[model samples]
Structures are given as C-alpha cells and as structure tokens.
Target: MTERESDVVIIGAGIAGLTAAYRIKKLFPKCSVLVLEAKDRVGGRTYTVDLTAANGTDKWDLGGQWVCRHQHHILWLLEELGIETYKQWLDGKKLMQIGGHRIKSHNSNLPPLPLLSLLDLGRALDKIENMVKQVPRDDPRLSKRANEWDNMTLEALRDQVSYTHATRDTFDIAIAMISGIRPREISALHFLHYSSMAGSFENLFEADNGGAQEWKVKGGLQQVSELLTDKIGKENVILSEPVKSIDQTEETSVLVTSETGQNYRCKYVINASPLHCSVAMDYKPSIPLTRQSLANRSPVGHLFKFIITYKKAFWRENGFSGEILGNGGAPVIPGCDSGPIQLIYDSVTGYGNPALVGFYANAWQWRLVDLEVRKASVLKHLTEFLGEEAANPIHFIDKDWTIEPFNGGCPVNTATTSALSFFFDGIRTPHDRVHWAGTESATQWNGYLSGAVQSGMRAADEVLTRLTPEIKLDGLLQELDNKFPEPSSSSVRGAVVMVAGSAMVAGLCMFMYWYLT
Candidate 1:
C-alpha cells in the first residue's frame, strides 16, 4: 500500500467531515488535513438534483434542503459562505387528506379534524411537550423515565391514549415525517429526544416564520459543502477512497488503510462518518462492545424524496399551498397496501420554478408496489389532490435513499429500541488518537444538517486540544450547548401556562399544535 502522513486525517467527506477539515485548515494553517471520502462527492445527505428536461435550467434539493431559523450554527455558516436564504411559500391554503376526504384550510396551526378527535390530539400534544422536556439532549439514557419510554414504541402510546383514527393517522404521519420510519418502529423515548433536541415539536414542524422547514438556500443546500470544499482546497480531499481499516493501538494511530490500497499514517484520525459506517471498518484491537452494539442498532432512515416539476404553480392558482398529509384515510385509515404518498410540500424553487416536493413512503410501502406502478399511482393521487393539471408535470425525479450506494438512507442515523439507554453514549467515545464526528453524535438537531456542523466543530476542538496539549481548551465545544440551557421548573410551568392560555384564546385544535409538534 502507498503510505503517506498528515497531521490530521478525516474519513468521510460529508458535511461533518468536511466542516471539521475546513475548521482545522482555517484555524491551524500549518497543520495538514487529508479528507478521505467513500463517495466521490461531498454533502452526504444534502444532495441537489438537476432536472433540465432535455435543456432548461431547473434544480431540486432532493435531500436535507430546509433549515430552521433556530439552527444558528448553520445560519452562521451560511453567512460565512455567502449563501443567501429564502422563506418557504405559505400564501395560500393547505390541503389535508382525511379519511379519504381532501380538505383545504387557510390556518397554519391546526389540521382539519372533528372536535372529539381534535381534543384527543390536543391532549396527546400536551403530554408530548411536557414529557419531552425531561429528555436531556446530551444524555437521554439518564432520564428518570428512560426505561419505560424506551421499551414502548410511539405506536403503544397511540393505543394507550386511545386516539381516534384521525388522531392516529396524524401521529403516524408526523412520526414518519420526522424519523422517516413508522411510528411503530421508533420508541417513545427516541421520539421524545427528537422533540427535546428541537426545543419542542412546534419548532420541529412549523414553517410560517421560525420553523424547521422555514427557509431554503438560494442555489441549493449542497452549495454549503461545495463552498467548504473549495475553501479546504481540492487537493486536500481525496474522493473514492473508502477507508477499509484503522489501527489505533499506537499513540499516533500510525496506520489507516483505504479499499483502493492507499495507506495513511497520521498522528490523529477523526472518523467523521456515522457510527454505522465507522463500525464497518476493521479496527485493530477491536472497538468496545458498546460501540459495536450502538452501530448495529443505529439504522439510517428509509425514505424516497421526489420533486415533480410543473409548468407553473397550478395549485397556487387554485388557492392551494400544496401541503398534503393525513394519518391514513382518517376514520378509514389507509394501510401500506393502499398508497405510498405520505407528505407533499410546495417546493417552488428560488428561480420561480413551479414544483412540488414530496416524501413518497417508508421502506415498507416502497416494497409493496413496483416503481412504475407507484409513479402512476402518485400522479393519480396528485390529480385527486389538485386537479387534471397535476397529471402533466414537465419532469419528475425520485431519489430513493434506501437504495443509494455508500448511503443506505437519508436524513441521519437513528438509535434503535433500547440502544440509546445501553450503548448510545459510547458512540462518540474516542479510542486513543481516533475521534468521532457526525450528526448522530450531535446533541442539538441530531438528525439535521445543522447537527452535523455542530458535531464537526466540536470534533475539531477535540483534535486541536489533543494535537496542541499546551492550548488546553477543554470546554470550547460546550459553548454551543450553553445557549440551549435546560429549562427550569418555573420556565416549564410558564410554558404550560402559555400553552393553556393559547388554548383558551384559540380552539383546542390550534392550542394543541402550538403546544406540541
């Protein structure tokens, strides 16, 4: 194997890995950085698609495209990169499919549902909002109700609350949208952690002014990685170099081998890949059992993101914002055998191109139907939701994350049932000169691109201190978490009061959504 040496070597050129490399090269100009990636391109989950039908300028963000106003680190990075942001369109009414009936509503807070079901949904949201505060982002395992919540799935919670079919469908869609998995697949504790990481479920879903899907990059989200790569210098990053193994027994971790017969003898190795990918590499002296267990349990999300380009914003002309969601069919809930369309958003690009972006379905639904048949069914359903105009799109492209090479899925990796309590903490624990950085290891916005940036910055600090012992900057990374301090008892009570007061102002439909996700 061809051997080389560098001060620091980072594996995987995703946002996390690239960010770390960029920070190192920027902060310590003398230190050399070698970024080895499995894929030829950067921006792991944040990939932008080009659909110029035979030749017209049209692009779509098929991956992690939206950023929340609350994600300050990402916003800061955008500003530094000279990337501009634009707000999502919400000028018209939204469409919701309930019990096979499609209803359009102008309200942003509440979905159209019966009063009985709305009350039940309200109670569920309140419970989630209050309970999620108990889950600390740093270490959810230590929470008082960790065990009970871990053992039970969000599905069990749905049953426990005895929600109506409408409420159940809403819960199912929300969980699937967040985790990219069915509600039955994710544990209650895991769901609560997601809520806590985002401050609350309301911030997680809302898009009006300050929500997660609040803004879009002018060019595309992938531009962030492209700009970072440009700053780091093309020569520093080596693509198509999938790392095969890491030997860290020595003080310097003197050897790291790639699948293509390249060897790196570096002082420190920053493993910037997700735990799932990291554990795949052969490690000398073997990693801890907890690390292996966490890797085994951490599953990437299974989702298919599609962008259907239209000649114009047809739905907007019809007074529709192009937002579509539901539990199933409502009281008649649609099962896996029924259809695959889960959520659809009005994704009109910054260039004033008319398009609709949608999440087709989870892995389970994808398996139920063939691709061509699924496409046809989606168009038929879109026709039902919009009109005949939906059937004739300029071009439509679908990205199936489940089948993507070098990446089994999209969004970010998630902790499986019981894994968080037993083994998740060990995921970021370094082995000698080897360290970790990925969205999965982030305490804030764990599954988003912003989380990846945070983890990358944190890992850079870690390596900096290790490389220059005299620097002694131990708590630099902790500063990011300081802004998100734990909520005090009084604050929690005040929040509850505020939510109660909102319910008193608006109906239960609006109150529950304001209180929760």
Candidate 2:
C-alpha cells in the first residue's frame, strides 16, 4: 500500500547486494539506493553465531568462512574494513578415515593410503586437472569437450578416471565438501569450471599457500556485509520484505512489490539473491523459459553444517591438527543411504574458544533426523576421529540450510547435466533492466565470498553505464582495478603443479615397482 522511489533498488541484502549498494553510493554519493532482504538479516550465507564456552561467549561462523591470499577482492575488502585475519590452524598430525572406521594419522599433506591407491589418486587428479584447464573461465560451454563433459555427471568422470575404491571415495568426499552435492548430481563440465574459477583443483582443496581455506576473518565473515550495510546506512536497508513480483511495464522505471504490499519504484533493479529465490518471483513480461530452466536445472546444494565448542582444544593438545577428512561409513551414490559426514576442520574462535566444525554433505538421510539424533551422530563420529573428549561439548549448533525458507540451501548451486552448456547465457545476461549480482554470476571465484564481492562490483558497473552513459571509470572503481587486478590464468599455474605432481607420481610408481621386484 505504500510507495517509494530510489535511483537503484537491490533485492537480497547479502554480501553481493550490499556490495552493489556500497559501490554505487561510493561512486555517486547523490544517487539514492534501497536494499530489501527477505530474511531479517544482512549476510545471506555468511552467518556468525555465538557459542558459550567455559571462558566466555565466543563467535563462530557456520557459513562461508574461509579466505585465501589469492582471493584478492575479499582480502582487499577485509583490509578496507579494518578486519584482521588469522591463518587456519593446520599444524600437527591429520586424520583420514576410509572404508568405515579405519583411521590413519599422517603429518604430511598426503593421506595415509597404500602406495597403489596414492598413485591411482595422483593420476586421476592429474587427468581431471588437465580437463579443467581446457574449460574457459567466462563460460564452461565454450570448452572443447563441453557437450561431452556436460552430458556426463561428475560421478561418471570419477568412475572413469579413478582405478581404486579409495581414490574414488576420496574424490567424492572432496566434491561433497566443495559443492555440497552428490557426485551424481553435478555435470563434469560444471565441476571443471568450478575448479577453473578457483584457479585449479588443488587450490580448491588445499588449505594453505594460495588455497581457498587458507585464512579466517578475525571476528566473523558476516562482518563484511554488516560493515557494508553500515556504510550504506541502516535506513537504506529494509529487512523481512520478500519481493513478490517485479513489473517493468514502465520503460524508464521498475516497480518492485513486496509480499506485504510495499512497493519500490526505481530506475534500475539488481537481483543478488540465489537463483532459486529469483525464480520464485513473478515477472511482468515473464522471464524467458531458458532462464527459468536454468534455475530449475541448477539446484541448490544440500548441506548440513554443525559446530561444537569444547572446553579445550584437546586434539591440538594431543598434537593433532584438528583436521579430519573421511568418507563416512562407505562410498555411496545417489538413491542410497550415505554416511553423515565428509570433512572437519579446526574452528577455534578468534578469541581462543576451542571448537571444531564439520559438514554433512550428500547425506540427505541425515536431514530427516532431529537435532538430537544429528548431534549424537556427529559427536560419535568426532569421538572416533578425535578422542573421547569430543563427546562432551559446552555448546553444539547446527544449521540445515535445506529447510531455510529464503535460502533453500547453502554454499552454491550446482549445474545439472548439460545445464551449464545449454543455458549459460541466462546466468549473467541482463534481462531488460534487471541485472544479476550473486556469487554464482562471478567469473574468478564463483561460489565464494570473493566471488560475491566481484559480482556486486560488476553489477554496479553495469548499472552505472546504463544510468549515465557518459560516466568515466575514475574514482573508487578505477582505484580498485589498479590496486587489485584480476588474477592471472590458472591454467598456467595448474600446468606447473600438474607436471611436478606427475613427476612425483612416476617416481613413486617406479620405486614401488622396484621394491616389489
């Protein structure tokens, strides 16, 4: 029943939307902006909650929390916001569990697997890495084997490349942790494209040295959005206002109606929500079937994240790195029960709250269980991996993003078979006046915090061009470009790493052959 006007309107007050608003306001201080969020919060996937420990209450991030040096945009944003970051605790022995309950501890990066399994894993990873290098960063469909790779699922590719059960299961676990989807659900081309976005498959999996999980923000990752909202002014952001429809009947302005009958009229609109949420809205002229199909094909990843705060860092005390990677009970495919966990990492708070975090990926069966049952299973698994000390925790918190109304799932959306190749244009192409700005629309670090920031900047740039055709690229936008240039091609880096890895694998194979003889 109420109406308002603004120069620009942004849907979803997550990092992407807020970043767009921030960028616009910074560039043109006179332009009015409004950000509407369905949930009663600012940060979308980046959630930071407090957990009570013996010492005091400390905060823990249950959502996207990791950052690396190579992720220039997010690192630059952290520096701009005066936020500090600490390296992820990764010293000491690490544990790996495979083939049910069989656990092994190793101090080095290599998992404690047999020589043959290790060699098999090395060859399989190298082969996949080579395939990933061929996928273009801007569009996966342009890859040489896009049609062939897109038609097959990642599970198919895994089966074809890996010779050992251990190698296959390890690859599955990594995929689950990275994408939050079963291997059978995502396209091989999509997986390769994701790897290319991170610069390489190794960067996606490695925890240090230009890897995705190298560092953690000191306070919480959510502070990025919070600080952006602060800079954008709290009055400019409206929460609990889910957009119902967008009508661009007027040639010069967009009319966005909320579920509560509140209307916002703006010159341009930027949709920064997940693909699923954007599909829920009713468009005036109707979105193209291709774009709608893109949303239907790209399903949000199902992920159940849990964090446990203990009285002390017992694993570290015992000289364990608090990092655990396991495939649960047994390897699994779609249409079958799966083990409850994939990976765990040291989640100690910045203020020294002893804690650990983990994820239940590709295990939809666990989602049906109650919190108590889920908590018990996770604690039991932790006890087996860490020690009896993990059984008792000061506080335990878990988030099943599947059930969240606004966000159907957490992390990111995975392209179904052939979706990336057939519907690639629907992702970033502007529909009339509505532009896209989610992490999924990014090119460099898609599905990551850095990606969200980059997409927002891109969207802001697009709108600036449309609004003032004569506007020049000077000021903050130009400064950012000069200070943090886009990263170099990952193919070059991946080739170097792959060569060294292949050499090591060949040497190991020869050594094992000689030893057996």
Clashes (backbone N, CA, C under 3 Å), per candidate, total 5, 0
Model 1 TM-score, all chains together: 0.90
Tell me which residue pairs clash in candidate 1. 99-329, 99-330, 169-327, 329-333, 329-334
Residue 386 lDDT, candidate 2, scale 0-100: 82
Ten consecutive residues with minimal summed lDDT in candidate 1? 326-335
Q: Which prediction has the highest TM-score against the true structure?
A: 2
Instruction: Indicate the residue-level lDDT of 380 in model 2.
Output: 78
Q: Best candidate, lDDT-wise?
A: 2
Error of 1 at 403 (Å): 1.1
lDDT of 2: 0.85
- Using Cα atoms with residue i matched to residue i, what is each candidate's TM-score against the true structure? 0.90, 0.92
CA-only RMSD, every prediction: 5.4, 3.6
